[model samples]
Target: MTREPTVAEQSHPNYVKVWGVLVALLAVSVVGPMFEIKLVTLVTAFGVAILKAYLVARNFMHLHIERRYVTYLLVGMVALMLLLFAGVAPDVMKHEGHQWKNEAAQKVVRDAAPAAKVH
Candidate 1:
Protein backbone atom coordinates (compact mmCIF):
# COMPACT_ATOMS: atom_id res chain seq x y z
CA MET A 1 0.00 0.00 0.00
CA THR A 2 1.14 3.55 -0.75
CA ARG A 3 1.66 5.85 2.20
CA GLU A 4 0.17 9.34 2.30
CA PRO A 5 2.43 12.40 2.42
CA THR A 6 2.82 14.29 5.67
CA VAL A 7 1.63 17.91 6.02
CA ALA A 8 5.24 19.13 5.66
CA GLU A 9 5.64 17.20 2.45
CA GLN A 10 2.34 18.55 1.13
CA SER A 11 3.42 22.10 2.00
CA HIS A 12 6.69 21.78 0.08
CA PRO A 13 7.42 24.07 -2.86
CA ASN A 14 6.00 23.62 -6.34
CA TYR A 15 8.81 21.66 -8.01
CA VAL A 16 7.57 22.22 -11.56
CA LYS A 17 7.70 25.99 -11.13
CA VAL A 18 11.18 25.75 -9.64
CA TRP A 19 12.35 23.60 -12.53
CA GLY A 20 10.85 25.98 -15.07
CA VAL A 21 12.71 28.90 -13.47
CA LEU A 22 15.95 26.96 -13.61
CA VAL A 23 15.43 26.10 -17.27
CA ALA A 24 14.72 29.72 -18.10
CA LEU A 25 17.83 30.86 -16.26
CA LEU A 26 19.86 28.24 -18.13
CA ALA A 27 18.57 29.56 -21.43
CA VAL A 28 19.51 33.11 -20.45
CA SER A 29 23.02 32.05 -19.49
CA VAL A 30 23.48 30.18 -22.76
CA VAL A 31 22.17 33.02 -24.89
CA GLY A 32 23.91 35.78 -22.94
CA PRO A 33 27.22 35.59 -24.76
CA MET A 34 25.52 35.81 -28.15
CA PHE A 35 24.93 39.54 -27.58
CA GLU A 36 28.71 40.06 -27.55
CA ILE A 37 28.46 42.53 -24.66
CA LYS A 38 30.99 41.74 -21.94
CA LEU A 39 28.97 43.24 -19.07
CA VAL A 40 25.71 41.67 -20.12
CA THR A 41 27.31 38.25 -20.64
CA LEU A 42 29.10 38.43 -17.31
CA VAL A 43 25.96 39.47 -15.46
CA THR A 44 23.73 36.88 -17.08
CA ALA A 45 26.14 33.94 -16.87
CA PHE A 46 27.52 34.47 -13.38
CA GLY A 47 24.32 35.91 -11.91
CA VAL A 48 22.26 33.08 -13.32
CA ALA A 49 24.79 30.53 -12.14
CA ILE A 50 24.64 31.84 -8.55
CA LEU A 51 20.84 31.96 -8.65
CA LYS A 52 20.64 28.45 -10.07
CA ALA A 53 22.91 27.14 -7.34
CA TYR A 54 20.74 28.81 -4.69
CA LEU A 55 17.54 27.37 -6.17
CA VAL A 56 18.95 23.84 -6.28
CA ALA A 57 20.33 24.05 -2.79
CA ARG A 58 17.25 25.68 -1.30
CA ASN A 59 14.72 23.52 -3.15
CA PHE A 60 16.26 20.15 -3.96
CA MET A 61 18.65 19.97 -1.01
CA HIS A 62 16.10 21.53 1.35
CA LEU A 63 18.87 23.54 2.94
CA HIS A 64 16.52 26.35 3.90
CA ILE A 65 14.56 24.03 6.18
CA GLU A 66 17.67 22.71 7.83
CA ARG A 67 18.99 23.79 11.23
CA ARG A 68 20.89 27.05 11.74
CA TYR A 69 24.14 25.15 12.16
CA VAL A 70 23.90 23.94 8.57
CA THR A 71 23.70 27.52 7.36
CA TYR A 72 26.72 28.44 9.50
CA LEU A 73 28.64 25.48 8.14
CA LEU A 74 27.85 26.48 4.57
CA VAL A 75 28.97 30.04 5.17
CA GLY A 76 32.13 28.82 6.87
CA MET A 77 32.95 26.59 3.93
CA VAL A 78 32.49 29.44 1.46
CA ALA A 79 34.65 31.71 3.60
CA LEU A 80 37.35 29.07 3.72
CA MET A 81 37.22 28.75 -0.04
CA LEU A 82 37.66 32.50 -0.43
CA LEU A 83 40.53 32.47 2.01
CA LEU A 84 42.19 29.56 0.23
CA PHE A 85 41.84 31.30 -3.12
CA ALA A 86 43.29 34.52 -1.72
CA GLY A 87 46.22 32.65 -0.23
CA VAL A 88 47.01 30.81 -3.44
CA ALA A 89 46.28 33.63 -5.87
CA PRO A 90 49.42 35.72 -5.39
CA ASP A 91 51.78 32.83 -6.01
CA VAL A 92 49.81 31.57 -8.98
CA MET A 93 49.48 35.05 -10.47
CA LYS A 94 53.16 35.84 -10.19
CA HIS A 95 54.56 35.35 -13.66
CA GLU A 96 58.17 35.68 -12.53
CA GLY A 97 59.98 32.88 -10.77
CA HIS A 98 63.45 32.78 -9.20
CA GLN A 99 65.06 32.54 -12.62
CA TRP A 100 62.44 32.12 -15.32
CA LYS A 101 59.53 34.35 -16.31
CA ASN A 102 56.14 33.24 -17.66
CA GLU A 103 55.91 35.52 -20.64
CA ALA A 104 52.69 34.00 -21.97
CA ALA A 105 50.77 34.33 -18.72
CA GLN A 106 51.97 37.90 -18.23
CA LYS A 107 51.09 38.71 -21.82
CA VAL A 108 47.58 37.38 -21.40
CA VAL A 109 47.05 39.38 -18.21
CA ARG A 110 48.37 42.53 -19.87
CA ASP A 111 46.22 41.98 -22.94
CA ALA A 112 43.07 41.28 -20.94
CA ALA A 113 43.40 44.23 -18.56
CA PRO A 114 42.69 46.90 -21.17
CA ALA A 115 39.84 44.87 -22.64
CA ALA A 116 38.33 44.42 -19.18
CA LYS A 117 38.66 48.13 -18.45
CA VAL A 118 36.94 49.03 -21.68
CA HIS A 119 33.80 47.17 -20.71
Candidate 2:
Protein backbone atom coordinates (compact mmCIF):
# COMPACT_ATOMS: atom_id res chain seq x y z
CA MET A 1 0.00 0.00 0.00
CA THR A 2 1.16 3.54 -0.76
CA ARG A 3 1.84 5.75 2.27
CA GLU A 4 0.74 9.30 2.82
CA PRO A 5 3.40 11.74 3.97
CA THR A 6 3.38 12.90 7.56
CA VAL A 7 3.52 16.67 8.03
CA ALA A 8 7.14 16.56 9.15
CA GLU A 9 8.31 14.69 6.05
CA GLN A 10 6.52 17.06 3.71
CA SER A 11 7.79 20.22 5.35
CA HIS A 12 11.45 20.61 6.21
CA PRO A 13 14.66 21.65 4.45
CA ASN A 14 12.86 22.65 1.27
CA TYR A 15 10.44 24.80 3.22
CA VAL A 16 13.19 26.81 4.93
CA LYS A 17 15.17 27.05 1.71
CA VAL A 18 12.09 28.38 -0.04
CA TRP A 19 11.72 31.24 2.43
CA GLY A 20 15.36 32.20 2.00
CA VAL A 21 15.07 32.14 -1.77
CA LEU A 22 11.88 34.12 -1.64
CA VAL A 23 13.60 36.82 0.43
CA ALA A 24 16.43 37.00 -2.09
CA LEU A 25 13.97 37.33 -4.96
CA LEU A 26 12.18 40.13 -3.14
CA ALA A 27 15.46 41.98 -2.60
CA VAL A 28 16.32 41.66 -6.26
CA SER A 29 12.97 43.12 -7.27
CA VAL A 30 13.33 45.98 -4.81
CA VAL A 31 16.80 46.73 -6.18
CA GLY A 32 15.83 46.42 -9.84
CA PRO A 33 13.97 49.72 -9.76
CA MET A 34 16.89 51.68 -8.29
CA PHE A 35 19.21 51.37 -11.28
CA GLU A 36 19.69 54.17 -13.79
CA ILE A 37 18.46 52.17 -16.76
CA LYS A 38 17.45 53.17 -20.27
CA LEU A 39 14.51 52.66 -22.61
CA VAL A 40 14.40 48.87 -22.28
CA THR A 41 14.57 49.25 -18.49
CA LEU A 42 10.89 48.66 -17.85
CA VAL A 43 11.15 45.23 -19.42
CA THR A 44 13.72 44.10 -16.91
CA ALA A 45 12.03 45.92 -14.05
CA PHE A 46 8.68 44.25 -14.58
CA GLY A 47 10.37 40.94 -15.28
CA VAL A 48 11.90 40.99 -11.82
CA ALA A 49 8.61 42.07 -10.31
CA ILE A 50 6.86 39.07 -11.86
CA LEU A 51 9.56 36.67 -10.78
CA LYS A 52 9.57 37.92 -7.19
CA ALA A 53 5.81 37.85 -6.86
CA TYR A 54 5.74 34.33 -8.24
CA LEU A 55 8.30 33.18 -5.71
CA VAL A 56 6.51 34.81 -2.79
CA ALA A 57 3.14 33.44 -3.77
CA ARG A 58 4.38 29.98 -4.58
CA ASN A 59 6.90 29.67 -1.80
CA PHE A 60 6.67 31.98 1.20
CA MET A 61 2.92 32.14 0.93
CA HIS A 62 3.16 28.37 0.61
CA LEU A 63 0.76 28.21 -2.22
CA HIS A 64 2.62 25.13 -3.35
CA ILE A 65 2.16 23.75 0.14
CA GLU A 66 -1.52 23.48 -0.59
CA ARG A 67 -3.68 21.31 1.67
CA ARG A 68 -7.16 21.71 0.24
CA TYR A 69 -8.34 24.85 -1.65
CA VAL A 70 -5.11 26.86 -1.82
CA THR A 71 -4.22 25.47 -5.22
CA TYR A 72 -7.43 26.74 -6.71
CA LEU A 73 -6.98 30.11 -5.03
CA LEU A 74 -3.51 30.62 -6.39
CA VAL A 75 -4.48 29.43 -9.86
CA GLY A 76 -7.44 31.77 -9.88
CA MET A 77 -5.29 34.71 -8.82
CA VAL A 78 -2.73 33.99 -11.52
CA ALA A 79 -5.42 33.55 -14.15
CA LEU A 80 -7.07 36.83 -13.19
CA MET A 81 -3.74 38.64 -13.31
CA LEU A 82 -3.09 37.18 -16.76
CA LEU A 83 -6.45 38.38 -17.97
CA LEU A 84 -5.88 41.89 -16.61
CA PHE A 85 -2.41 42.12 -18.15
CA ALA A 86 -3.68 40.75 -21.46
CA GLY A 87 -6.38 43.41 -21.64
CA VAL A 88 -4.16 46.30 -20.51
CA ALA A 89 -2.27 46.86 -23.76
CA PRO A 90 -5.37 47.18 -25.89
CA ASP A 91 -7.00 49.44 -23.32
CA VAL A 92 -3.91 51.67 -23.21
CA MET A 93 -3.10 51.78 -26.94
CA LYS A 94 -6.50 51.80 -28.59
CA HIS A 95 -7.61 55.03 -30.24
CA GLU A 96 -9.90 55.03 -33.26
CA GLY A 97 -9.80 58.70 -34.30
CA HIS A 98 -11.51 59.76 -31.08
CA GLN A 99 -8.51 61.99 -30.33
CA TRP A 100 -8.97 63.68 -33.69
CA LYS A 101 -12.46 64.75 -32.62
CA ASN A 102 -10.94 66.36 -29.55
CA GLU A 103 -8.49 68.25 -31.73
CA ALA A 104 -11.29 69.39 -34.01
CA ALA A 105 -13.28 70.64 -31.05
CA GLN A 106 -10.29 72.62 -29.79
CA LYS A 107 -9.81 74.14 -33.23
CA VAL A 108 -13.47 75.15 -33.36
CA VAL A 109 -13.16 76.82 -29.97
CA ARG A 110 -9.98 78.62 -31.01
CA ASP A 111 -11.44 79.77 -34.34
CA ALA A 112 -14.83 80.82 -33.03
CA ALA A 113 -15.55 84.53 -33.32
CA PRO A 114 -16.01 86.43 -30.09
CA ALA A 115 -19.63 85.98 -29.00
CA ALA A 116 -21.60 89.15 -29.67
CA LYS A 117 -23.98 88.20 -26.79
CA VAL A 118 -22.76 87.99 -23.21
CA HIS A 119 -25.36 87.31 -20.52
Candidate 3:
Protein backbone atom coordinates (compact mmCIF):
# COMPACT_ATOMS: atom_id res chain seq x y z
CA MET A 1 0.00 0.00 0.00
CA THR A 2 1.20 3.55 -0.76
CA ARG A 3 1.62 5.87 2.17
CA GLU A 4 0.10 9.34 2.09
CA PRO A 5 2.39 12.34 1.96
CA THR A 6 2.73 14.30 5.21
CA VAL A 7 1.38 17.85 5.46
CA ALA A 8 4.79 19.35 4.76
CA GLU A 9 5.04 17.52 1.46
CA GLN A 10 1.37 17.63 0.41
CA SER A 11 0.93 21.16 -0.96
CA HIS A 12 2.83 21.02 -4.19
CA PRO A 13 3.95 24.18 -5.98
CA ASN A 14 4.54 24.68 -9.70
CA TYR A 15 8.28 24.12 -9.64
CA VAL A 16 8.61 24.30 -13.40
CA LYS A 17 7.43 27.90 -13.42
CA VAL A 18 9.86 28.79 -10.68
CA TRP A 19 12.67 27.07 -12.58
CA GLY A 20 11.79 29.00 -15.70
CA VAL A 21 11.89 32.29 -13.82
CA LEU A 22 15.25 31.39 -12.34
CA VAL A 23 16.65 30.52 -15.76
CA ALA A 24 15.42 33.80 -17.20
CA LEU A 25 16.94 35.74 -14.32
CA LEU A 26 20.23 33.89 -14.78
CA ALA A 27 20.27 34.86 -18.44
CA VAL A 28 19.61 38.49 -17.57
CA SER A 29 22.37 38.49 -14.99
CA VAL A 30 24.82 37.05 -17.50
CA VAL A 31 23.88 39.45 -20.31
CA GLY A 32 23.62 42.51 -18.03
CA PRO A 33 27.36 43.12 -17.91
CA MET A 34 27.70 43.15 -21.67
CA PHE A 35 26.17 46.62 -21.84
CA GLU A 36 29.15 47.86 -19.79
CA ILE A 37 26.98 50.11 -17.63
CA LYS A 38 27.99 50.01 -13.98
CA LEU A 39 24.51 50.68 -12.63
CA VAL A 40 22.87 48.10 -14.86
CA THR A 41 25.50 45.53 -14.08
CA LEU A 42 25.24 46.05 -10.33
CA VAL A 43 21.46 46.03 -10.34
CA THR A 44 21.05 42.99 -12.52
CA ALA A 45 23.81 41.05 -10.77
CA PHE A 46 22.73 41.74 -7.19
CA GLY A 47 18.98 42.08 -7.71
CA VAL A 48 18.68 38.93 -9.77
CA ALA A 49 20.90 37.09 -7.32
CA ILE A 50 18.65 38.11 -4.44
CA LEU A 51 15.53 37.16 -6.36
CA LYS A 52 16.94 33.80 -7.33
CA ALA A 53 17.96 33.13 -3.74
CA TYR A 54 14.46 33.98 -2.52
CA LEU A 55 12.83 31.81 -5.16
CA VAL A 56 15.02 28.84 -4.29
CA ALA A 57 14.46 29.31 -0.57
CA ARG A 58 10.73 29.76 -0.84
CA ASN A 59 9.89 27.21 -3.54
CA PHE A 60 12.49 24.45 -3.24
CA MET A 61 13.06 24.67 0.51
CA HIS A 62 9.36 25.28 1.25
CA LEU A 63 10.31 27.92 3.78
CA HIS A 64 7.07 29.84 3.25
CA ILE A 65 4.99 26.94 4.59
CA GLU A 66 7.47 25.87 7.22
CA ARG A 67 7.14 26.92 10.85
CA ARG A 68 7.67 30.67 11.32
CA TYR A 69 10.52 30.16 13.74
CA VAL A 70 12.58 28.40 11.09
CA THR A 71 12.54 31.50 8.91
CA TYR A 72 13.23 33.71 11.92
CA LEU A 73 16.25 31.61 12.88
CA LEU A 74 17.65 31.80 9.39
CA VAL A 75 17.23 35.57 9.24
CA GLY A 76 18.75 36.00 12.68
CA MET A 77 21.80 33.96 11.69
CA VAL A 78 22.25 35.98 8.51
CA ALA A 79 21.97 39.23 10.46
CA LEU A 80 24.61 38.09 12.92
CA MET A 81 26.91 37.15 10.05
CA LEU A 82 26.47 40.58 8.45
CA LEU A 83 27.13 42.27 11.78
CA LEU A 84 30.35 40.30 12.23
CA PHE A 85 31.45 41.16 8.73
CA ALA A 86 30.72 44.83 9.31
CA GLY A 87 32.74 44.85 12.52
CA VAL A 88 35.77 43.26 10.90
CA ALA A 89 35.63 44.67 7.40
CA PRO A 90 37.22 48.04 8.10
CA ASP A 91 40.38 46.58 9.60
CA VAL A 92 40.52 43.79 7.06
CA MET A 93 40.14 46.11 4.08
CA LYS A 94 42.70 48.63 5.19
CA HIS A 95 46.21 48.16 3.83
CA GLU A 96 47.74 49.98 6.81
CA GLY A 97 46.93 49.80 10.49
CA HIS A 98 48.44 51.24 13.62
CA GLN A 99 52.17 50.60 13.60
CA TRP A 100 51.92 48.41 10.51
CA LYS A 101 51.87 48.70 6.77
CA ASN A 102 51.36 46.37 3.81
CA GLU A 103 53.28 47.78 0.90
CA ALA A 104 52.36 44.95 -1.45
CA ALA A 105 48.66 45.26 -0.72
CA GLN A 106 48.78 49.01 -1.19
CA LYS A 107 50.64 48.59 -4.44
CA VAL A 108 48.08 46.12 -5.69
CA VAL A 109 45.24 48.49 -4.85
CA ARG A 110 46.96 51.42 -6.56
CA ASP A 111 47.67 49.34 -9.63
CA ALA A 112 44.10 48.04 -9.78
CA ALA A 113 42.43 51.43 -9.31
CA PRO A 114 42.88 52.56 -12.93
CA ALA A 115 41.71 49.24 -14.33
CA ALA A 116 38.67 49.32 -12.06
CA LYS A 117 37.81 52.87 -13.09
CA VAL A 118 37.88 51.92 -16.77
CA HIS A 119 34.99 49.53 -16.17
Candidate 4:
Protein backbone atom coordinates (compact mmCIF):
# COMPACT_ATOMS: atom_id res chain seq x y z
CA MET A 1 0.00 0.00 0.00
CA THR A 2 1.13 3.57 -0.78
CA ARG A 3 1.21 6.33 1.77
CA GLU A 4 -0.18 9.82 1.30
CA PRO A 5 1.84 13.02 1.50
CA THR A 6 1.79 15.13 4.63
CA VAL A 7 0.34 18.63 4.45
CA ALA A 8 3.83 20.15 4.75
CA GLU A 9 5.02 18.08 1.79
CA GLN A 10 1.86 18.57 -0.29
CA SER A 11 2.63 21.99 -1.68
CA HIS A 12 6.07 22.70 -3.13
CA PRO A 13 7.14 26.07 -1.84
CA ASN A 14 9.29 27.20 -4.74
CA TYR A 15 9.97 30.57 -3.16
CA VAL A 16 11.62 28.91 -0.16
CA LYS A 17 13.93 27.06 -2.49
CA VAL A 18 14.62 30.23 -4.41
CA TRP A 19 15.57 31.88 -1.16
CA GLY A 20 17.86 29.01 -0.27
CA VAL A 21 19.61 29.27 -3.59
CA LEU A 22 19.92 33.01 -3.18
CA VAL A 23 21.27 32.71 0.36
CA ALA A 24 23.82 30.13 -0.76
CA LEU A 25 24.95 32.34 -3.61
CA LEU A 26 25.16 35.30 -1.30
CA ALA A 27 27.16 33.28 1.20
CA VAL A 28 29.67 32.28 -1.45
CA SER A 29 30.01 35.86 -2.52
CA VAL A 30 30.52 36.94 1.05
CA VAL A 31 33.00 34.18 1.96
CA GLY A 32 35.12 34.09 -1.18
CA PRO A 33 36.41 37.63 -0.81
CA MET A 34 37.28 37.05 2.82
CA PHE A 35 40.02 34.57 2.01
CA GLU A 36 43.26 35.54 0.30
CA ILE A 37 45.09 32.25 -0.14
CA LYS A 38 44.44 30.44 -3.41
CA LEU A 39 43.92 27.01 -1.85
CA VAL A 40 41.62 28.37 0.85
CA THR A 41 39.63 30.28 -1.72
CA LEU A 42 39.28 27.17 -3.88
CA VAL A 43 38.14 25.06 -0.92
CA THR A 44 35.62 27.69 0.10
CA ALA A 45 34.37 27.94 -3.46
CA PHE A 46 33.83 24.18 -3.71
CA GLY A 47 32.10 24.10 -0.31
CA VAL A 48 29.60 26.71 -1.42
CA ALA A 49 29.22 24.96 -4.76
CA ILE A 50 28.34 21.75 -2.95
CA LEU A 51 25.79 23.59 -0.84
CA LYS A 52 24.17 25.01 -3.94
CA ALA A 53 24.15 21.61 -5.62
CA TYR A 54 22.55 20.05 -2.55
CA LEU A 55 19.82 22.66 -2.55
CA VAL A 56 19.18 22.13 -6.25
CA ALA A 57 19.05 18.37 -5.88
CA ARG A 58 16.81 18.44 -2.85
CA ASN A 59 14.31 21.00 -4.10
CA PHE A 60 14.45 20.91 -7.87
CA MET A 61 15.33 17.30 -8.55
CA HIS A 62 13.26 16.19 -5.56
CA LEU A 63 16.00 14.05 -4.14
CA HIS A 64 13.84 13.98 -1.04
CA ILE A 65 11.60 11.72 -3.06
CA GLU A 66 14.38 9.17 -3.41
CA ARG A 67 14.66 6.15 -1.16
CA ARG A 68 17.00 5.57 1.79
CA TYR A 69 19.37 3.42 -0.26
CA VAL A 70 19.92 6.28 -2.67
CA THR A 71 20.80 8.59 0.20
CA TYR A 72 23.29 6.03 1.45
CA LEU A 73 24.79 5.84 -2.01
CA LEU A 74 25.17 9.59 -2.13
CA VAL A 75 26.87 9.62 1.27
CA GLY A 76 29.22 6.82 0.23
CA MET A 77 30.10 8.60 -3.00
CA VAL A 78 30.94 11.76 -1.09
CA ALA A 79 33.16 9.76 1.24
CA LEU A 80 34.96 8.15 -1.70
CA MET A 81 35.57 11.54 -3.26
CA LEU A 82 37.05 12.76 0.01
CA LEU A 83 39.33 9.74 0.10
CA LEU A 84 40.47 10.39 -3.46
CA PHE A 85 41.34 13.96 -2.59
CA ALA A 86 43.25 12.91 0.48
CA GLY A 87 45.16 10.31 -1.51
CA VAL A 88 46.25 12.86 -4.10
CA ALA A 89 47.34 15.45 -1.56
CA PRO A 90 50.40 13.48 -0.40
CA ASP A 91 51.68 13.24 -3.97
CA VAL A 92 51.22 16.98 -4.42
CA MET A 93 53.22 17.64 -1.24
CA LYS A 94 55.98 15.28 -2.37
CA HIS A 95 56.23 16.98 -5.75
CA GLU A 96 56.15 20.40 -4.16
CA GLY A 97 59.38 19.58 -2.25
CA HIS A 98 61.12 18.63 -5.52
CA GLN A 99 59.87 21.84 -7.11
CA TRP A 100 61.35 23.85 -4.26
CA LYS A 101 64.73 22.11 -4.72
CA ASN A 102 64.75 22.86 -8.45
CA GLU A 103 63.85 26.48 -7.76
CA ALA A 104 66.72 26.76 -5.27
CA ALA A 105 69.17 25.32 -7.79
CA GLN A 106 67.98 27.78 -10.44
CA LYS A 107 68.48 30.65 -8.02
CA VAL A 108 72.08 29.56 -7.41
CA VAL A 109 72.69 29.37 -11.16
CA ARG A 110 71.24 32.83 -11.63
CA ASP A 111 73.43 34.30 -8.89
CA ALA A 112 76.58 32.62 -10.29
CA ALA A 113 76.03 33.79 -13.89
CA PRO A 114 76.99 37.42 -13.11
CA ALA A 115 80.04 36.29 -11.16
CA ALA A 116 81.15 34.20 -14.13
CA LYS A 117 80.80 37.24 -16.44
CA VAL A 118 83.07 39.29 -14.11
CA HIS A 119 85.77 36.55 -14.14
Cα-based TM-score, every candidate: 0.72, 0.46, 0.78, 0.51
Q: Highest lDDT, which number?
A: 3
Clashing pairs in 3: none
- Number of colliding residue pairs in each model: 0, 0, 0, 0
Question: lDDT tens string, model 1, 19-78?
Answer: 999999999999998998999999899988999999998887777877679889999999
RMSD of 1: 5.9
> In candidate 2, how many Å is residue 85 off?
4.7
Model 3: lDDT of residue 109: 90
**Candidate 1 positional error at 81, Å:** 1.0
Task: Name the runs in model 2 displaced over 4 angstroms.
Answer: 1-9, 14-23, 38-40, 67-69, 84-89, 97-119
Question: Looking at candidate 3, what is the lDDT of residue 115?
Answer: 100
Cα lDDT of model 4 by residue, 1-119, tens digit: 89876533754757676776768786875688587777767766776677777777776656677666877898899999999999987765443363555556566777899999998
Q: After superposition, how far is residue 102 of candidate 4 from its true place, in Å?
A: 9.4
Better of 1 and 2 by lDDT: 1
Error of 1 at 59 (Å): 1.4
